[model samples]
Each structure stands twice: as C-alpha cells, then as structure tokens.
Target chain A: MRLLLVEDELEMAAALGAALGRYDMILDHAPTLDHAMAALANHVHDGIILDRQLPDGDGLSLIPRVRALKSGIPVIVLTARGAVDERVRGLDMGADDYLAKPFAVEELLARIRALMRRSPDIAPITARIGNLVFDFDGRQASVNGRILDLPRRELLVLEALARRQGRTVQRSTLEESVYGYDDEIQSNSLDAHVSRLRRKLSETGAGVEIHSIRGVGYLLRPSL
Target chain B: MRLLLVEDELEMAAALGAALGRYDMILDHAPTLDHAMAALANHVHDGIILDRQLPDGDGLSLIPRVRALKSGIPVIVLTARGAVDERVRGLDMGADDYLAKPFAVEELLARIRALMRRSPDIAPITARIGNLVFDFDGRQASVNGRILDLPRRELLVLEALARRQGRTVQRSTLEESVYGYDDEIQSNSLDAHVSRLRRKLSETGAGVEIHSIRGVGYLLRPSL
Candidate 1:
C-alpha cells in the first residue's frame, strides 16, 4: 500500500517511513501542508497519516482538502494532544482514526489495516479472469487450481496486466509497476517479460490471453 | 465500488450514474468544485470522475487536492476539451486517465474498472485468520475450506471484526459497516448479531474467535 505522511519533524517522518516500510507499504513524506498538497497532486495513495501540528499549518485543515478529492481515503491524524476533546474534534472534522504522540508502530499498523479493511472502495485482494486466479498479496497465480510457477519479473508483469484485465495498460504504467522509480530498464525488458508471461499462460492451458497493443502496452483478456 | 463525480451538467451525471450503477458502483454527484470538495471530506470513493469545465472552476484544480489525500485513488478527467494538448496536460497534472465528451458509458465503465484494478492500495480481496477465511467480495466465510452458512447481519458483524483480524474494531465503525448511514439501530442490535455470530463460529469449529472489548467494540483473533 502507498501512503502519504504529512509530518513536519524530520526524525518522526523517517522513523514512521521505516516502520511502515516493513509492512510492505510505501510512504511519501510531506514536511508541511503545502508539501503534502504538492505530493497529493502527483501521486495516489491508499491512506494518509497526517500530523496535526505541521510547520506550515494545522494538519486538520488538510483533511477537508483530501475529502474534496476522495472522502473515502482514510486519514489517521497524529497529534501530541491527548485530550479527549481534541480527539473528538479530530474525528468530527473527518479523520478516520487517530494516534497520540509516541505511539507504538504496531498499533499504528493495526489501525491503518483496520481503516483499509473498512474502506468500501478497496479492490478485492484476489482477481479471477477466466480459469486464471491471481493472489496479489502472495504474488502467485493459479490456473484451474494449479499454481503457475512464474518467475518474479513475469509475475509482476502479469500483475500489471491482470489488475486491469480486459483493458490496455499504457506502456509507461506497466514499466512503473514492474520497475521501481530508480530501476534501470533496457528497451526490450518489458517486452521480454510479457512474451514469457504469454507463453507460460498458454503452456499452462490457462484460459486467459495477453495481447500487446502495438506500441501502447499490454492487456489481459479472457480467451474466447 | 464508490465514485465521486464532479460534473455541473445534471443530465449527463444522471445518465452516467445510471450506467455505472449497473456495474455495482455507487456514484456521488458534486455539481461544483466546492460540492466535490465537501463530498470528498465526508465520504470515501474508489475513483473520481472529474469534468474539466465545472460551474465553479476547472476540475483540473481539484486533482491536486485529491492527490493530497489518497494518491492511489484514480482520477479520470472528463471534459469536452478533447484537444490533444489538453489531454496530455491533464495527465501531466496528475489525472490518472482522461476521457473526452460524447464518450460511451460502456467505455467509461471499462476505464473506471481498469483504474480500480490498477490501484495499488486496494486491500487484499480475501483475508485469512487461522483456518477461517473471509472473502469480502463474496460476503462469505469458510472454515477449513467448508462454507459457513451465516445470515446477512451476522456476516456483516463477522466482516467488521474479521477485517481487523486481531485488533479491536471500534463500536461506531462496526455499526456503520453493518447498517446503513440512515439505519436506526436498536441498542442491542449489534450485540445480538455478535452473540449469534459467536455461537455460530464455535458451533462450526472455526479457528478464529471474536472477543468483545467492554465499552469499545469487537475483535476477531485466532482461537488460542
């Protein structure tokens, strides 16, 4: 899961980022409300962890801005104020959950997961197309109940395609999903992965087809 | 799935809403940027279908606000400004996908689904606690792969608790999940559901246990 954390303190942001990373979450740190807003404009996240007291403005104010875009994204407000009224006020202002200062990372992770589970728009954990099933969390794909022993890169390619089954995923989007922001890519690396994935799907007798959209990217469609 | 649609045109919103609803999506309409922002601050949405020409301002202005909150939430900008440069600019400014006016509702639905599937933070579709498995999409639970026949309300209660797995889910959150926003819940309705669910879990030899925290909410943890 990707998260945008609006916290001013450098040490806290680093610490929180490290902790959240262990749980397989990518966190982008925003030191101020303006920075947070800038980050939000560029990327998408599953959740936001906001610090009530930021260098630029009160984090509570950012909540309304977030609500304006997608009210369903969970916002966990972090504050040193442990007063019951403050907590109540935060909730009243639309924070999904809260955390007092010096909170345990484990508790924070638990709360984040709880908020995510309750999020109505969260896509299903697994996706099934034709006779093929993909367990995204496990990074495994199965056809007709038989697991396909796919290599890591092939699985990532398959994930990018399967996630948007029956639709064309742009070439850049697939590259971003498969390779990290800093990862180097050869011209034909993505094509190689897609070709191998295509062959594997056919060899397994999986009732799914991966079609390359000429110069665009690739699409996964159920076999006719 | 839920979506926030920011469009000033009433007829188009209604037509699009009806078409998207057939695919099991709930569309919340916002006539202006103010309304869209207000809606975003309150409810959650899987995606945002934005119109570049709004009564209040350019819908492009709202993209950053949404990105601020949940960067992962897909934004598909819809407008009559079909100029090639306009589309590229919208995407450059953080819109995930763009569609021009006079588009087919079928195409819109397909685009929306593709965006939802591409979302990275969509929580896992299925969750497991010990030998008990809960499929959020199917709204069913199984023990040792055996389907547990649970009533609607009971299943909802179980879902609220199981989503958190070992953590305690607050009472208010659980109520909102099980009942509608306008549901006039009785004092003991939740309690009744929990009682029945507990009995059913024990009777079915389910591996998970639901523990109620006094004055708080319920939690589902593996049976010790």
Candidate 2:
C-alpha cells in the first residue's frame, strides 16, 4: 500500500510516480510542503496525494496540518479547475479524498485506492468501557488511577456514546450531534446536554449511566 | 447528489439510469438486494452504486450492512473483470468506491463525482467537539452530557477521532486507520489498546482526555 506523492510538477511528479509505481505501491515522492513535512517526519505513508499547487507551500494549508498530524492519514486533494474554493476548502481541511486538475492517471490510481480502501476500518486508537478509557488518538484520559478534564463537547459526547456502545441516542440524536442538521435547535437542548452529562457523572464517581428513554433516546450504560 | 442504483441488469440498469439522470443527479432505480433495502428504507442516497454481480446478494455483504446502518453512506463496487481479488475483497468489504467492468461512462461519472464529493466534509452527520458529540450517519455518541458505552474497536476509534474534530492522531497514524499496509498486524496490540483506552475514560465519569505524545501518537483533548 504505502504512498505519498505531493507533486511540484517535475513532469507531473514523474508521470505520477511511474503511474502509481505500477500499482503495487510503496511510493513516496513529495515536491514540497517542506518535502511533505520531511517525508512525514520520516516514513509511514499508506495514503496522501496532496498538491493543490505547491513549490513550497499552500496545499490548503497542508489540509488542517495533515489532519492535525495524521489522524487517519488518507488525504487525497489535488485541485485546480478554477480552484472552486479548493473543493469546498479541501473537505473542510481533513481531506479523505479528492482529485481534480485534468485527472485520470487511471483516476489518480482510483482515488488512491479509494482512500486506501476507506482506511482499514480503523484499528487501535483505543476506546474501551468498564475500566474507562478513551485514548482518542492519544488525546489522553485516565480514570481509576486519575486525571481528567474532558471538555470538547464533552469529548464529542463521549465519542458519540462510545461509538454506539449500548445504543440509544435520540433527543433528536443529541441535537443532531452538536448542531449539524442545519442548526437552530433548542427545545431543552438535548436535555440541557443530558443534564450537564449527568452532573459530570455524579462528579467523577463514573458509575456510568446516562440513561433517559422518555420520548425514546440516550443510553451509555457502563455498569448502570 | 442523491444516488442509489443497485442493479440487476435490465439493460445495464436502464443505461445507467439514463446516464445518471443527465448528471444533475438523482436516481432511485433498484432491482434487487431487496430493491436495495427497500430503497434504503425509503430514500437517503448520496452515494451507493453496488452490483458486484448481485443476482440475489453478495454485494459485498452490503458493506457491513451499510456501515452498520449509516456511517456516512458511500458504497461503490460494480465489479466483473479479473475482479482483482474482487477488487481487494471489495475493498475489505466496506466498498467506498470501485468500478471495474469495461468501465467509463466518463469513468462512471468520475466515480459518481468521487462519491458525491466525500459528503461535504462530514456533512449533516451532526458533529462537534469540546464537549464532543458525533452523530456520524447516526452511529451516535455524546459526552459532556453523558452516554458512553463505546467498543466496536472503540467505535472505530471514536469514528476516526470524532470525525477529526481538532485532530492529532499518530501511532503509525492509528495503524493505517486499521491495518492496511498489507494487512498482517495481529497486534502492536496498539500499545495495549492505548493502555485499555486510558482506563475506559475514568470509568465513564467522561471528563475526557486521551493524550499521549511520548513518541508521537493519540489525542482526543476535547479542548482540555
């Protein structure tokens, strides 16, 4: 798999790294973005096409700084046809895929193997229950032993109810998961954000309940 | 946008639904896959183009049953030639894009406009951070306001870190978002699953924190 082309037009990045290195892959080329962040701080590249014009910089400000330092590293973006607002600001700067500029080097190797096959179904960045942990790509969190603060929309609603741990969600699905359904929500805002996330889990006891099924919604039962 | 052309033939699904409704886009046509899951339970298509020789089923087991019920709906298989290992096992059966068989309808309208341009950067899948909440195609999650059972590999590592909300994820970039360097991982065990996800986020008190920079990897700060 491994890839990371970048492109500064050295004959179209050597005809797209010898036509995507004859499809077996393991090609790293980079022509800038400071040699693509010094070959992304030395090796490791399953996907990354980049390019929105770069001899030195401005690849949509390195897509939210390579999604704030490799969040799932698929990227793609290439852009051109009238920039068109760098294809909606390069997928709001996280870029999982995109390719414009008179494309088709076999459609940029089929959109970099469809963003390296929809990024391997996400492995270990960690998220556990019972003992309580949410390494969320190492933003760090500890419970039993101690240490916590959890602000960011209460850790994105506890990683969206631990990514569907027991399931339930609704209060219009937590006001459409942080107001996206085209915002304007109110009506007791997902029950005042689940009553301040159940008083911060009973002020750190962490029994983990977050129940409420009234009109039918909410649920994150760790032990009750 | 608005697509859902499952396919059971009948003249190449009426000439690819009249050239994808003259590219303005909008095609509900189905023929099987139980009329494409009863038109995906009465309409919801922004991307979906199956047909991996589906007479009755095997459209790559409907990509984890449509991402276990909508994790940003983007499916595209359409195989038939040498089937390059059924296009890498239908891209590890999550098929977020693939189109083989004598392709070209303008390469299937640039792979359906690159799968309806990656849902306008995590579209109306309700999202937010700093109190975190991610509806992500209704997979669901919530935090500061409670709800957190989390486990399917920690909800795909909190849906790739709550849809990249204020990102920063390394550790071999979250193991290629899940072992795609050519599979074979069995275990780094991702640092003991990030130390059992920091003890299950303080036993669900959900205050949050998953930081770890030691050698560079992980971050779910939620603005702490």
Task: Give a tens-digit lDDT track for model 2, residues B137-188.
Answer: 3344555445556654555565555554434565665665433232347766
Every candidate's CA RMSD: 26.7, 18.3
Q: Chain A of candidate 2 scores what in TM-score? A: 0.23
Task: Give the local distance difference test score of model 1.
Answer: 0.77
lDDT of 1 by residue, B34-71 (tens): 99999999998889999988888899999889988876
Error of 2 at B55 (Å): 7.5
Model 2 residue A213 CA deviation in Å: 22
* Runs of candidate 2 exceeding 4 Å displacement: A1-81, A84-224, B1-49, B52-72, B77-100, B104-113, B116-118, B121-159, B162-177, B180-184, B192-219
**Distance (Å) between predicted and true CA of B82, model 2?**
18
For candidate 1, write residues A158-206 as lDDT tens digits: 8777766655577887776565433458788888888888898998888
lDDT measured at residue B192 in model 2 versus the true structure, 0 to 100: 70
Q: Ten-residue segment with the worst summed lDDT in candidate 2 chain A?
A: A114-123
**Candidate 2 TM-score over all chains jointly:** 0.27
